[model samples]
Target: MIILTGVGDVKTAIESLKHGAHDFILKPVNVEELLIAAERALERRELLIERREYQVTLERRVEEATRDLDAAYTKLQDTYRATLEALGSALDTRDVGTQSHSRRVHGYSLSIARTHGVPGHQLEDLEQGVLLHDIGKIGIPDAILLKPGPLTPEEWKIMRTHPEIGKRLIERIPFLRGAVPVVWCHHERWDGTGYPRGLRREAIPLAARIFAVADAFDAMTFDRPYSRAISFAAARTEIHRCAATHFDPAVVATFLSIPESLFEDIRRRSLEP
Candidate 1:
């Protein structure tokens, strides 16, 4: 932007500079000065361009890292889902007559959770909680768990530990930690008479409250050794009667709001391979 002219005109030099000229060379240009000014301008432009390029590259790297993290997290969630399914299937094999109880309850609980606006990872956690709620029974003595007769008061004490046991077993598992509340509190009654912690009413987590209703209905309508299978309608009636006492009244109301056909469909699916 330097203006090289024959005259040593101060006014012209000032005008050239006002119009963005970097320097004004006199009639006989100082070759060294011209070279230095041009070099300095190029250096400043190069630095600015390099800085902008670095910023763009840095932004791209950060975006890529975010995408990678999200993909890895999604993969982790899928692995946990598979592991939990295997555990539920294992329970079916280990316990006689439970065949699809875990799966059924998982389906039922997921339905209820969705109705209450719970979704995504929270829904997944609730499913795991309900499916593995009885996993602690695995630790109970065969004499107590497999006993055909009613458990004695002492035996009941041992049976009750399953919730705590279940909680302890999976406490170390990162994926199952969100499920611990349901696993520990599912057996707690609305009236606070239920086992382990005796937590009542709102003291119970909503996930567990939702689960209790699903578990009861599934147990009654499904075939098991201790009871003959009852009709789904009959199971609904029994649950409705127990509302606010054995189950959360709000949860029962919501549970009943779901179409009976949906419950029937879930039951039918549970029967499939």
Candidate 2:
């Protein structure tokens, strides 16, 4: 940073500065002036070192703060999921003979969605949607939700309202709004015969379309008061039969592509006795 130059060489001094020389002196330098210049340069260097250290300390603090913020957000996300799961599980409490339905359907929905290329946090959103999908059934009387057989026409009308109710309820929570489609439209049919919005084809969100297949598969394979459980192959057959009618054809195809072992393993875990 220190340089020797002619006292009259202003141009050379400027050039040296342009080239990153911090200080310079004349060739016929006074010893005192030269010592002063050297002392000033050393002081400047120390100041620069201090400044760099301060910047490093500031950067480290910022990084620590960012990491803490990320961790807090992660914990908040976990709490959100746990709360939704609890609410979803409460649905099973209202109905008898079917415990862990929400968890089962969540697992099934996740599997189907992943097979359809829904990756990362979108998959988590779908999981949230699955857990909270049945939340609006809280408004329905147990008489309708737990009916051992088919619901009456009047009961069916009320039953269909659950999707809209769920949509309204969940959109109130900003973070959960991303999952509204699965909660509200999972029952939609590919042919537009579904209730509520009756969205057809690509109009339905892929998450909901994927959920429809998962929900149906779980429904058919699991025991209900009106019917006994069916084999995985039988459920798969039913899903294929309804493709493009009750379910998305692409989603159905994806569901079929999944190995039976994956489903069997999920089913084997945490089934209610």
* lDDT per residue as tens, model 2, 153-224: 999999999998889988998888988989899888899999798788999998899888888888888887
Task: Name the lDDT value of residue 47 in candidate 1.
Answer: 86
* Candidate-wise lDDT, in order: 0.87, 0.86
Candidate 1 lDDT tens digits, 106-189? 889999889978868788778878778888888998788778777899999888999999999989888678889888998999
Candidate 2 residue spans exceeding 4 A from truth: 119-121
| lDDT accuracy of residue 231 in candidate 1 | 89
In angstroms, give how far residue 230 of model 1 lies from its true place. 2.3
Error of 1 at 148 (Å): 3.9
